[model samples]
Target chain A: MQVQAASSSRSAQLPPNDPPGGTHRRAPEKLPRSRRRLAPYGFLLPFLIFFLAIFLVPIGYAIYISFFSTHVSGLGLGPSQTTTAFAGFSNYRQAITNPSFYQGVERVLGFGIVQVPVMLIFATILALVLDSTAARLQRFFRLAFFLPYAIPGVIAAILWSFLYLPGVSPVAGILHSLHFGTVNFLGSHSILWSIANIVTWEYTGFNMLIIYAGLQAIPQSLYEAARLDGASDFQIALRVKLPMIGSSIILTTVFSIIGTLQLFSEPEILRAVTTNISTSYTPNLLAYTAAFSENNTNLAAAIAVLLALGTFILSFGFLRLVQRRSMGVSL
Target chain B: MTLTTPKTPRPPTSEPKPVRYDAKGNRKQRWDRRSVLTTAVLFVVTVYFISPAYWLLISSSKGPSTLYNSAGFWFAKFQFGKNISGLFSYDGGIFSRWLLNTVLYAGVGAILATLLAAAAGYALAKYEFKGREAIFWTILSGVLVPGTALALPLYLLMSKVHLTNTYWSVLIPSIVSPFGVYLARIYATGSIPTEIIEAGRVDGASEFRIFRTISLRIMSPALVTIFLFQFVAIWNNFFLPLVMLSNQKLYPVTLGLYSWDNQYGQAPQLISYVVTGALVSVIPLVIAFLSLQRFWRSGLTAGSIRI
Candidate 1:
């Protein structure tokens, strides 16, 4: 089977050189030109159908709903009495002006700024270590590092929640034993950091794997060349390896930034244990609160649209900035 | 990422070739001080990474009261079996039901997604069609748009169609992975030679048949990579289901556990159940990750380097 597969693949690779088969010539002539041209579309049909239904349609609906609001008259108790009206940019304005939404945005920005770099640095370090010459048990360590990533985010949050709980946390127990006054990870001031910790723990290894893969792609000749120039391992890593994996680092950063904006599960799960996290703790959470808790679907739709736009801008903007910087450096 | 590169026809084979200094370099500087330092630092980081999971394992095996009273790290009374039984029997076996629901969502959804993505990616990779770039860009944009941002809109849209509480709500959305499509396209382009598809065509094989028999067989490793990605993604998904599903029966394990953890204040015993359930929920994924590490690692490399 393997031989047949391999030989067929080789034949497939040399199609232009091969003489046209008698049956194939007849088959194409029998099929309409348009139908032949449409074969790719036929292949793409399934993905496009789901993509339209699940992605494009919802985005369209969100944009449509973002422009309208239901105005309730009198007691506002009945769906019949509440009439939908065009609100133009009012919903967007409201979303922009809402203090909670801004707070959520600020919080996410803060989280991303600090957390992304820390996580990426850790990931870079781990990736470097794993890719190092002297690294022992590389497979075991790689798996161990990436094991948390295999665990679902919610489960990671739950597991870490137990670790963060005062009486339940082993770290906290050790801290208490050392006579450090009880530290509250779930406290309002620390909860964001706590959430950052969970996010970091869940994602660092996955990012490490990406960076490590990038490291793997680096030519050994480059390392030998650097070593020949009397560069230490650290110098080689900092100058050559780090610069080489710049795109991967940027990619991981962009992903981490986008992920930070979508921070819901950790905060949402943490909300159960602590009063620090409100329903509107993050933009996504705020949008959820508006849609479900407040029953303001229009406002929620506006928030979602705005958030999506923000995400697109931020992600693309970062990409563009990195591209320009790299170009500038190269030039 | 663009699907322009068609080089590197076999990625898995490229792995061992890159390690040019694996034996010679290692033996030259075996147990050097720098190597020892690097090893020490990595060991510390690995310990930090594993500690919480280690804590979860030990903590879950403790009795409810002992969880709070005992040293969080130590195995205080082996209640692993007891916890498992308690977790299974909890709330009329709701935990088991949640696990099944998760499997249904992640497993089936991933399989269907892999197939769809494979098809789409193969099309994008192999075909020269009008508006292909436009379609690719549109889907690429979908990759950047965070799913959390879409959850509200999807909820509203699903409710408009009266499918909000149904399995289709989660299942439908979970399968439309733009990244999967992106990866598939890259993999198809990199690994599967277009000449083969042309050869299959010249052999009077239908395009679908060519894909099924020739392209798919060659693309199996990449497809597994795509499947594992989509599987882990759908498995880890929390917000989409949390919004679409209020019905406990339809809740994925993540959402189900969150809801239970919310009520932990009222019934503290639920804490142990949550821990045990969290541990249980992670087992399948751990197994999957370990088993498919090669495919996933290659997939990651393919995604990064190709881009």
Candidate 2:
């Protein structure tokens, strides 16, 4: 209400800058009152348009289609006989019950539980080490650590697939040259972890940069104060630096969780090297298989919805947990 | 007009402290063990991180016959030129087409995404309007909604409009980056002062003109940062194109290489193409990252510091 009054009064009090000859620059205040009020909206319209088409509408459509399933009658020989009908909660039920979908979810949950912490730990360690006064060549190390992130995830998977291939693997060849026996990285038992290794390699450096940024943001005065207090460098990093960057740590953690749930490219590409990864090895892979290969769009939509909800819930739950533990730390 | 400022004021001590050495011209000796351990750990981890890429660099120079039988870490035969020709000439130069499509998608998509994001983010930062917070939060929620989750439904919607199996399917969705808006808003608030904007307003410049003429110039640094990020993102993006484009001509290099890698059973030689193509694809982005390290590092902190 106040804004409306302000805009109206501004319009009323506007100087009559419009020249009779129309040779001067006109003031924006001379524009219509409604356009003035809607100016911000005008700027936002392009982004909002695509945001609606891509984010909101798709989410709404996913929910809409999830509740519907296709039906076929009379042996389903003709397109006319097949129809999509509202399935109530049946698609959700199927998604929940299907061991394939849930198991894929389980696999990714396990992947996140193991991968996120280990990756973050590695990132935190690297960041702390680089931030340390003792570390030399900080810029060079940072670049090397971060270079893998520039490699696209699928490409990283392919690159690693070569290392995992028994024939071409230098790592395995070295292992074989040693007294230890040959190791099968693509074995069903280790394929998930092999994928995990790829994820860790691809993301650890990216996460390190975030944590490192947080480390950088810590005011140098804090370190000076800690030094004046006779705190050792290790103590300072552990006590001062770690506590200050709680929010960045949480930010990376949340993102990693989300990325973990969206694990499609690595395992999908790895399918080229090994048959161990099934079409439903991950929830996302499962959804793609359902939609494109199985021709079950409703099931795919339901699984996608479930995956999204799981991501939100897990990340939100983690945030809440950290916030409660930290008590006033915001992320 | 008197309020114009070219850059954000530099905060005190943002740079890391200069290394301190003792009278002997070595790192402080009191913590020699810690220093040695830090250096050793960093070196080892750097090696761990770099060895794969180093191997890739080495392998990209070798011939297909030498890939498996030879020392994986050491070069056997210098086949770099042959491999390049083979990579480009394979499947009637489809690899070049994929690279072009990738450039087209990522280049156009990132530019549009950055512009829209900057505009919306600027308005959010500079203006007061009803439901402003609501709109901002709605967009923020878009960040949490995973892209893979949206792929199926987005594909369905595109197909409904008979727009699937085309570049538009990938490009349209690629332009909606919620994270870009989030970054832009943070950047604008930090860098572009409102007084300069008001000065423009008093000069009778339209708001859009002020944005274009003054604000964009001020925000160019952030704009470049956003463009690089969104470009790398769209280039790295795999699943969207995987879901949207069936025609190989529309495939990004990532997807195109994946197709070749997937078909290794039928064509063993494609492995060489995939390896060489992988190396070729990453070179430009790797150089970009190394060159723009300062920009992205600052951008990351700017976007994440508040959180």
Candidate 3:
């Protein structure tokens, strides 16, 4: 099977060489032409159906509903008294003016700015260490680091919550024994970082694997040449390996940024233990509460639209910034 | 992010080449400052990452009374068996049902997704038709859109069709991975040959048959990688199920555990159950990832590298 595949693939590399079947075909090409035209559509049908229904239509609907509002007259206790109208961006106006929504956005931005770098840095370092010559038991270490990633985010949050609570937390117990005073992991100020720690622990290994793959793809001859140039391992890592894996780092950063904006499962699970995390602690959480708990789908739709727009702009802007910086370096 | 140059032929099956490192250097034995630092860092980070899993193991074995009083990292009593039994027996074995529900959703959803993506990606790679680039880019753009932004809207859409709170609500959305489609296209283009398809066509094989017998066999390695990714994704998914499923019977393990954790205050016994449940739910996927490391590494490379 492998031999046949390899030989056929070799023939494919040749340009339009000798017609298919090479004179073994006595039939007209009409049927083949028609079938070829329709085949791709058949293959694509299932994926496109779900894509349109779940992805595109929802996006369009969110944008559509964001312009409308549901109003109630008098006591407004009955569904009969409720009426929906085209309020013309009134939901957007309301969302913009709401401090809770803005605060959620602000909190997420702060979280991303601090968290993305720390996580990616640790990932890069771990990848470099594992890739280095001194590394031993690479498989075991790699598996150990990545094991946490296999745990679901909600589960990780729960496991870590036990470690965060004062009475059950071994880490807190250790800190108390060391006379560091009692530290509240779920405090209002510390909860975000607590969540950050969960995100970091869950993802650092996964990102390390990505970067390590990048490191693997690098030609070993480059390392040899750098070593011959009197560069130490540290120097080679900094000057050679680090610069070569820039794209990988940037790819992880983009993903981390996007992940930061959609923070939901961790905080939502942690909300059970801590009073610090409100329903509006993050933008996605804010949208969730607005739509479900508060029964304001229109406002939720507006927040979702804005959140999507913010994500697109931030990622696109980061890409542009990186592009411009690289182009400048070349110039 | 280097693309495969035209001159460098890919392996026949497109399985990622085994990891290779130079063995000529005898310098590994040297205990330099950098090596010490690197090893120490690895040790520290490993402990940091594994400490919680270790704690969960120890804590799950303790009864509720000893859970808080005993040292958090050490075992107090052997209640692991009891805790696990309680976890399963609670609410008419609802936790077991949630585990099975997770398997059904993730397994079925990922299988369907891999087939759909493989077919579509193969088509996109081999076919020359109108609006091809337009369709491909539009699908690729779906990768950029955050799922959180879409979850609410998708729920609203599902409710409109009376599909919300059903298995379809979660399974249907989980299967549409734009990123999977992207990876499948790249893999197909690099691995499959046009001449083979042409010859199959000349032999009067239907396109679908050709895909099932020929293309699918050749793409098996890539397919496994794609399926693993989608499986892990759907397995780890919490938000979608949380929003779509209101029925405890329908809850995936993640959401079920969250519900129990929420009720931890009233039913303090649930702490052991939740801890045990978390450990049970995590085992299968962790084993899957560790064993399938090679395939996923290639997947990560394929995703990161520009093709």
The prediction achieving the highest TM-score against the true structure is: 2
* Interface quality of candidate 3 as DockQ: 0.49
* Candidate 1 local lDDT, B103-139, one digit each (tens): 9999999999999999999888877778888999899
**i-RMSD per candidate, Å:** 5.7, 3.4, 5.4
Give per-residue lDDT, candidate 1, residue A306.
88
* Tens-place lDDT digits, model 3, residues B31-127: 7776787778788879998888899878889888888799998889788999988999988999999999999999999999998889888888877
Worst 10 residues of 2 chain B by lDDT: B1-10
Candidate 1 per-residue lDDT, tens place, A60-87, comes to 9899989999977777456547789999
Question: Which CAPRI tier for candidate 2?
Answer: medium
Write out the backbone clash pairs for model 2: none
Evaluate residue A133 in candidate 1 and report its C-alpha lDDT on the 0 to 100 scale. 69
For residue A112, model 3's alpha carbon misses the true position, in angstroms, by: 0.2
- lDDT (Cα, tens digit) per residue for candidate 3, span A1-331: 3333533553464334344545453443444556767888999999999899889999999999888888776685565466899999889889889899889999999999999999999999999988887676677788899989888888999998888987878899899999999999999999999999999999999899889888877887898888789998789889999987876777788778888999998899888888999999998999999999998999999999998899889987887778786652210
TM-score of each model, in listed order:
0.91, 0.93, 0.91
Which runs of model 2 end up more than 4 angstroms from their true locations? A1-14, A17-34, A74-80, B1-33
How high is the TM-score of chain A in model 2? 0.91
C-alpha lDDT of all candidate models, in order:
0.82, 0.84, 0.83
User: What's candidate 1's DockQ score?
Assistant: 0.52
Tens digits of lDDT, candidate 2, B12-42? 3333335322322455444567777887878
